[model samples]
Target: MLSKSISSLAKRVSSGLTPLRSNPEFWLAGTIPWLKTEQLGEKFIYSTTEKISKIALKKTSIKICRPNTLTIAMYGEGKTRGNVSIIKSEMATNQACCNIELDPELADFEYVYYFLKTQYNELRSLSSGVRKNLNSEDIKNFVIRLPQELKDQRKVAAVLSALDAKIDCNNRINAELEAMAKALYDYWFVQFEFPDANGKPYKSSGGKMVYNDMLGREIPQGWVVGALSDWIAKDKTGDWGKDMAEGNYTLSVDCIRGTDINGLNGKGAVAAPTRFILEKNKGKILAPFDLVIEISGGSPTQSTGRLALMTSESIKRFSRPVICSNFCKAISLKNSPYAFNFAYLWKSAYENKVLFGWEGKTSGIKNLLFEAFTTKYVVCMPSQHLAQGFFDFVCPIEDMKQKRLKENDELALLRDWLLPLLMNGQVTVA
Candidate 1:
């Protein structure tokens, strides 16, 4: 659905691609995380940690694309293909991506970035066939419309960039808050350094440790060993069959898929496709503190048990109800005190490959062995007071994370809404 104004503007503008030339700094695949999922749709990305060497760049047929360069993934699966990004630093990319070095005199880079974000689906459609890949030529000839007034373009970019910056700020805040909570979790539960009677670190201050046969180690005397099932009030994999074609279902809701759980404990503004389901099945609707785990679709390198925590504030981002996709299992905790703790536990298990033992293969895909997973996994059941203490200490931080997440959702919505309107000139900067 291309806007008439955008279509007209695209016709007027010329597009170009950086010429491929032999370079020594060629990444040669696997050298760096040359490709990314989070970087897509972002205004700027710097691969400081996953960067290619100058020698590799020199040996390969790669060009050092300049900053503010808008690029798109020329090939990949799902949303990976045709996704756009702006280079924050001079970087080299594989041929699978198309780099567009826009002329500043002709267009504002930020305005073009936002335009591409809105037209992503259409851009994606240019590629055809089973693999759905676009080539450099496809991007070279791709069109963009620029405002006659550079200030107008800047104004539009400014409005959208402000929203993006705010969202980025919130994400930074959430990352810091999550790190704080995780550090506390590791200190108290893993290191056994919980607060003691005098508000001192418990295990470090020698607060009553005892041997526990179940864990094969000494734990705080009062804690009991229990399975994850002990804390779960309800557990079930999600539904998928009820499509819009199904006469039973009416409105559609964004279905959270396995790929959507991007973070260790939760997702950050994952884009999910909508699916229709029966209103009665609203019971499957995700609630705050509900744990959504990926039960299927894992690769050898990636594990199956990816986890995400639904926040009370975050859940409201959807208009109707949000439900997990079939590949995920939603677990509602019996109590709120265990929410943050269990999220951390599951994350640790996934990261450490502890849960891989509870995985089975089906149709060439890795699946979480549900029954075995529930029965085999063990948890240290700390006293209710201790659990409550941890929750009380972290609750404010959690609340802050959710509020920021919710704000990001709103900001994204507003930015998206304004994009086409601004591009079509229905909304003006003045």
Candidate 2:
């Protein structure tokens, strides 16, 4: 039954094509073996930093697809959480390029890309290989259902595309807002610039001033030196004694190694495909709005002690949970109004210190000790009004970010719902 269907589809495709048997380009000019799956980024196309020689490209028969073509990675490693992305660029040396040219009549490229991404897991399950690979034959043999009308395809693509376009716009807005806030921070804090009483620009009176050993420059008058521990609570006693029961509580890592920090959620929210969990460990269950810091294990001097704000939901889901391996989670004090900004500030300073301290070191992962973080430092405690004012100024940007994320999530759901339906003809474009 499958063979007959495939043969019929092949004949139909052949009939639609303008035959050119003699053209050399009609056949693939070259074949290449993918360098490795790990080399591919979340965006399609592996980085040139990991490129192999032209000789290596000839080892495999895979041909590159054009930019914006609908493609899929037939084999998936456990990495990427089963993601599928459209081809965004020309062929790379180490990737199994798509062989099938996209059918403009059958589907919109972006629509097809989203559909395939949604069905990524199903495709992976059908793929055969120790490393998980799907061949071109497998893809061609797979059936796709479509509405006979081009208008229907356009309609379906348009609906989904609008959401994606909105999401992209929100992302841009968020980026701009963040850039604005960072610029403000640099101007006031780093550059020591503030308005004088007469609204004239002055260095010392308008901004908080402080002396810094690191900078060898005197800062604004009101600024003071401090550590994260001063504003946040650090459970340094190392006592998780009673909370270690296996079933009663779960421990989670403060950070997931090899994952992007931007993707991590706090405030007791659980992101899908939770990769890290804690065994029984003695620690307080994290609370909502609590700041969680990755105290250990990132680039040794860089990204160590990175921080995130835990929502209330995350605390409920993973409270009493063991701290996952290779991470430490710290919660900020409830009273600290500036905890979020403080987290960012401390992270920046700590990361800078690490970079300076670990120059030329092979180990990127840094181990954070509780004593150093808790006992040694103080944090600037600006008045609640000031903190609130700062947050108010930036809240719109944060809202834009949240909106973008929500739109992306919705787009993902729609894409997933459409993939198998369109592929199987259950959902037609018309």
Candidate 3:
């Protein structure tokens, strides 16, 4: 039952700094992964969104924390503060991170990480006064309680780590599967290699090609080139329903915002807030094959047209009818049966930075030029049969990915439910 401050258990507590961006030598041609507060929250961080040069590391206060070094966010917008993660490889962080190196003699590294995991809310509340920020002093002085025996700590950690390891494995498998699906799409659609009547890859087996003035390139016979708008059936802006049920606001829905799109696509956690709306707005409910695109809120490095493909499985993941936030639009393709083709088209456009050219700004927030993008951007539509073939092949891959996601969700639930009980000695590994 005895507890000690983190200062007693940690060998060192420190933070890193961002080097001067004005120096090209500091940022350009870098290989070292540099993390910011927004990158925290994952259990094991293997990579980062941004990296720094060795010159920056030497010239600045940044130091590469060893593997397993626990980093916590000190301050950020929204719920970015109090987020925590353990770097799986050598990495440097910004000033907003509170990095703690545990003393092997006084504490087990995994044990301490799990203990802090249960204190997320407490850590968030540590910030006080007008300037809300947690400093190194607060992290070092934070108290922790664990079994005195180091072996017992390891046992507890082993139990929790097993679940996390499984989840991590599933995520890796899912990533690989997604890559395969993308490759299949590229080969069949982009390369015009769908199977011909004889079951051979179309383009590779001397398939016919025709040149079109609109595309300024050769495409397979029967394929049509047209603007992005020709493929779109409907595009409607979303509504942010009332926060609470009252008057005509009787229907309850899970509101998906621009920030939540990637989460639905397995990139991160879905954090949509529930809202109450009028029953008459039921027509806005999202269904399978509907694509949601973010129209606003992009950063300098990112674009505003991030999308989410709605599948039957995706809809099933939500307990109630889902609605997009006002910052997004729900788009339905004109070709109902070939919806997957449009989804892949949008994805390819997004990955190629095509959305960057279609951005307009209002009040400093970047918004997608939805009308111009959908009305002017050109695309090549493959035959219905080829499109359907690609869809059939990718459906199983996506379904399997969804299954793994569901499993991870359940495993996380079990781990969270057992964490407090295990930490307090109410339950033992064996």
Q: How close is every model to the real structure, measured as TM-score?
A: 0.82, 0.62, 0.90
TM-score (C-alpha, index-matched) for candidate 3: 0.90
| Runs with alpha carbons beyond 4 Å of true place in candidate 3 | 20-31, 50-61, 128-131, 363-365, 424-430
lDDT for each residue of candidate 3 in 319-423, tens digit (9 for 90 to 100):
778999999999888776677788888888999999999999998989999999989988898888778777888878878887787777778889999899988
Show the colliding residue pairs in model 3. none
Per-residue lDDT of candidate 1, residues 1-430 (tens digit): 1322332333222222223335433433435334343356556777734456555555455466677777787777667887888878766666666667766766777888888887788888899767877766666666776577778889988998999899888888889998998898889899988878888998888789898777789989888898888888887569774556478787578788888888323355577777888767878888878899999998777889898888866666566678899999999988878888888888888999987788888779888997687777887878777788888978789878877776777788898899899877788887
Over 248-319, each residue of candidate 2 has an lDDT whose tens digit, in order, gives 434433332223334443111224222233343434445445565555555422455556555433333332
Top lDDT model: 3
Superposition-based RMSD of candidate 2 using all C-alpha atoms, in angstroms:
9.1
TM-score of model number 1: 0.82
List the RMSD of every prediction in angstroms.
5.0, 9.1, 2.6
Q: 1 or 3: which has the higher lDDT?
A: 3
What is the Å distance of residue 209 in model 1 from its true position? 3.6
lDDT of each: 0.75, 0.48, 0.87
